[model samples]
Target: MSLPPWISEQLPENGRVNTKLTQRHVVETMYQSDRPFFSLQQIQQRLKPDVSKVTVRNRLDDLEDRGIVATDPLADSLTLYYIDHPESEWPLSPAGERALNRESAETGNPFREFLQHPLVNRVFREELLRSIAWAAIGLFGWAILVSSSGQLPATIWTVVGLPILTWASLTVGTIGVRLMTGNNLRVQSTEGLDTISLGGVVLGGFWAVFLIVVLDWSPLVTSGLYLFVTATYLVFYKRVIRPRFDASVED
Candidate 1:
């Protein structure tokens, strides 16, 4: 396959010419594909049979380091790679421009562009909204239970608090991971966040039990208070935090 002239121009002319050529081939293949993401094995299989998996892996790592590609943090076992933005990263040759224009014309989906915008890319805005919906459903169920029984069940707090707690933990854990990694917006692995979130759930459950048994607080009051806190947090996320992220992308 003929590579774009721009890609050939970027290749090194040193002793590592063959290696760079191979890497260029890998990149050109990724750039030409319609798929947004590809696993190591998939790329290797698509290319010449002689191309080794190690070669493909190394090339992908190099591309990612150069900000030409991005990977999914949630993907486990097999790492996925996708072009970040070829138009911005590389000076596109005429052929490359034609290919991109053709792909855009074929797809003809304006909404996809909005979804790919940096403001919406890294942040879990949709996930946050979904979590709120789940918590609301849980809250509705809790209310019905309280009305029918006239008292909170011992396990009612667990059911009512779990969604909000999970969402809270995920939000806090994501921020904590970003801070710890010094990325401030993105983290390499979500394992730390997941661990923190699980711990929060356990601690939250215990705290709810403590409030019920030791303080003699009504479960209704405790549950209402938890829901109230969650509502406040949701408002803050939508009004304050989300706008900041959106503004950052705009800038």
Candidate 2:
């Protein structure tokens, strides 16, 4: 294989990529590190002043579009990025393979370490699909209630309530899951927890609301249950979910 033409284009000869140090620093770090893949946020840690993760991600997406990088979307919506070069020395055509191979030899498996998550694989499949699933579940559950008929005939309440709850929960869950997954991919690639955070507490609270207020729920009851469940979730989150997740990642 040959080096993709765009690869040569993205990394212009020294002194040409003027104006920004962070973008240049990112490229240099990738060359120096032996990781098959890295996240925009993970790459940010190598910077001196420490730019925001959002900027890093935009740069990454730009690099990918320019054919200087490639991404493998992982569980929980995290994307793993690596330099793009075709096979050359490895009987392929590119030099990027060398970096990836050296990374694996030192780091062990890359992909396997990416899949572990409380959110699961389906969540990462696509944002749209996950939304649809939550909508379906919510709608179906409420329809069931409506069919039963009762006081205030909340049958409509659930049919309406569940979907509304699912939509809200799905939004928060997607954000949390996506961030967590990205960090996981980063750890697996870079060998540490430089990218992941433990703020699923916000999401746990969001999910707790969904559970408590689907139907036949008073505000007091909803608030009470939300706090109880949120605390329980936080406990499991810090202890069970987060740890198991990190344990699955490398170093």
Candidate 3:
């Protein structure tokens, strides 16, 4: 295919030749025979002495800045670069090809551009880090209560029940942020209200469970508190809290 109009007009003979050659080198190195993406470092390594890692990154950045390449970064922040246009001319993964064709037909970008915002990305990162801490502290405290209370399903409750729920929220949120923001905010506001709220709920749940098993509080008191706390989480989870985190990047 012919070079794009701007690329042809602005770049010189030697520079144009070198760029095309480099682009080919990058493309060939990044092509995964079986999948849609590769790590930026892996692509850099493939180039060896031909180019430095920073140079490879800079080149990739230039291509992206020029709108010649598309980058899809995964949960861990490793990027997968692909040629965005000329889908038929470039190697396309089944998924990549489908996304391109659909976008080409849809007459709009489905996810929106806000996903690329840097602040949103930082918030997501902070949020995820806070979430891990919250979950860890929560699970540790809950496990202590369950073990101390002589509760039923010791293994299940401690091993699967509490921790799994916490992690599931984290994993799902990570994906949800990416889908919404197109950027990884990964920031956690940690506002006093949020901190107090999250801590209160987890602690309340733990104590409520403890009261039921160890303190022998009346079923009305024990069960009511547990149910109340659970309901508290459910109501806010779907509404007040989640929207704040929508499209953030937290790992």
- Per-candidate Cα lDDT values, in order, are 0.59, 0.56, 0.59
My TM-score estimates for the predictions, one after another, are 0.31, 0.30, 0.27
**Predicted candidate 2 versus true structure: per-residue lDDT over 1-251, tens digit per residue:** 22222343354323221234434456557656766567666787876554677777776766667666677777676777776655432122224556655664477554554454323343455555656767876776566556545742665456676678877788667757665653322233222332333344465455456545554447687678767876786677678866765555422
Off by over 4 Å in 2: 1-6, 12-22, 88-96, 99-251
lDDT of 3 by residue, 174-195 (tens): 7577656545433344354466
Please report the TM-score between candidate 3 and the true structure. 0.27
Report the lDDT tens digits of candidate 1 across residue range 75-154: 56867677665564544444666788678657866677545544334345644654575566556545544544535654
What are the clash counts of all predictions, listed in order?
0, 11, 29
Give the clashing residue pairs of candidate 1, or none: none
Give me the displacement of residue 185 in model 1, in angstroms.
Answer: 47
Candidate 3 local distance difference test against the native: 0.59
Q: Model 2: number of clashes?
A: 11
> What does the lDDT read for residue 187 in candidate 1?
18
Which predicted model would earn the best TM-score? 1
Model 1, C-alpha of 63: deviation from truth (Å): 1.5
